[model samples]
Target: MSDNGTNTTDATAYDYSLYYSEDTSFFTPCNELDLKAFASVFLPALYSMVFVLGFLGNGLVVCVLVKHRNQTNLTDMCLFNLAVSDLLFALTMPFYAHYSAVSRWTFGEFMCRFISGCHHTGFFSSIFFMIVMTLDRYMVIMHTHKVARYRTLRAGLTLSAFVWLLSLCVSLPLMIFTEVSGDLYGLVCIYAPDNRAWKFYNVFVTNMLGLLLPLVVMVGCYSKIIPRLVNMKTAKKHRVVKLIVSIVVVFFIFWAPFNISIFLQFMQREGHLPNECKFYRDIKLAITVTETFAYTHCCLNPIIYAFVGQKFMKRALQMLSKWVPRIHFPPSRDLSEISFRRSSVTSKSSDITSTIMM
Candidate 1:
């Protein structure tokens, strides 16, 4: 019925009449006991931490972007959208935390669908935005003159809108297929497609659009960007390049294991991987652990940006300095360091090789 992305249907085949019923007298409970204790204790706590950190981090990122919205480059515009996606993704963690804490869905059918849609939408947007950001960097650093006209605010916003529109199309199945099922033993919200074809379609599309395509495009973009970096002499811009590279690698590090496990599980379900109790249990546990780790990416982004982006740090400091009267520095630190970037953009607006966009 499926290939990847952890839909319950992708595993063991089930007879719907037994699990789905109008009778309230009898019900089927979610039988995910192998990792029950681990899930109940670990998932809620981990999700809670991610929620707090991601929400705060992405919130600050958005604030910084808005404060400098007028001054932001194309990459910053991409990052602004990325932060928004992370914040939205973080918003879904609490619902999942609750789902894990109690081992059930108490929020009703409507929310079951809503949360799933939001979760997948956030995933699609995050990776797609990263790909877009990478392409922007590649163009800005490698093909400056040719891509100059498309590096402006209106162009960036237009491209962003298209990515979201495509993301929406990819994520629409979640809202349509997700459902709250099982008995009062505890309701479970999951991908519950009415048919096997739909199940296969969902998994296939999700993997291709959500993971594989973005990864391929990003790898290609970096192939070009890295060589340009090697030849560059600018000390300050190296930090920006490093930051972007670190974010890409970290993001893949977090998400790859979970997605790989899902793919393996699909293979097993389709008789490709060895089907045994031990292997099945291992895959299930791997998914639980990797999924937890993957969620941390949302929380780690701002830390990476702050650590590597000097200009961003300077701006962040400027923002904080406005609020903290006791922490005083020379007022000249604000726009003087940033004005050079604006001036550079104007003269070399067509020549990306002349100056790197911060």
Candidate 2:
């Protein structure tokens, strides 16, 4: 037996020659063909649709948040940052779509780095904001007395700045390593590590810091929140807790498999298991789909937080009533001052009530 590229290996392989042999036919079970077919038809469609939807959805979120900036709270600030990250991520999806469509990257070196950098930046920022949101929820639910001191608008802005800075730091390696290289027909943007160990290191860092740790935090926060909600006497507050819990559940369900798949792929690449196994191939395809859906989780958050959490639709309608064509109101400084004072008083009262309740 000699090494060739045809024969499919079982779940273990130390050397290439273990699977491929000179006596074996050049084409066995059409493994590459199956993989190509799946990648060609499925990946392009999945990436394209998710890209379009995510772009539009996140764009709407940004617009709505901007429009209602006066109503911004700590939660809204987190949502705004999340929407920005998603929008940037969605912008990069076209390049991925092009690659999937043509089975290659035609973009040059700078774009390759930029796109990869943006991808990592968006991913890190998204996860960071999510973790912050979970902590925000925890403070509001479990540590309400402390939220007023730490969860202010200024604090949220500072936290968001830190998130962006952290994301930028994490993503710098992508800019350094990713480049467009291959044949004329099939350029790929990949991290050209000095050694295989470096590749595994990159995968492990991304999987652990970017995905797994945040997931654990989210689950832990929501677990405590849910039990408290169940015991709450206030039905309205319970509903809000349930809604937040649902968001966390949805995030976990969408992202958990994608992150796990990255770990598995790293294992396969490191020769921990044979890549030629049918199970590996099938799981790879599942991973592609799962990742596509997981990335779109960003777009869903704005809807959950804005329209659903804050009743943006109804509030928008109320705000629009003042703009009817024939409606006119005489200028009244006294009334305006009274309204402003009333709002300030109401807000202070609500804060006091919340503090006392806690």
Alpha-carbon lDDT of model 2: 0.63
Count of residue pairs whose backbone atoms collide, per candidate: 0, 0
62-161: candidate 2 lDDT, tens digit per residue: 7767888897878778888988998887788778766766666677778777887887788789888878877876777687666668777899899999
lDDT of each: 0.68, 0.63
Where is the poorest 10-residue window by lDDT in model 1? Answer: 12-21
Per-residue lDDT of 91-199 in model 1, one digit per residue for the tens?
Answer: 9989988877777678887877777777778878977887787677777777766887867888888988998888778788756877766643355666666777876
TM-score of 1: 0.82
Scored by lDDT, the top model is: 1
Q: Which segments of candidate 1 are over 4 A away from where they belong?
A: 1-8, 11-34, 183-185, 237-241, 305-307, 324-357
User: Which candidate ranks first by TM-score, i.e. highest?
Assistant: 1
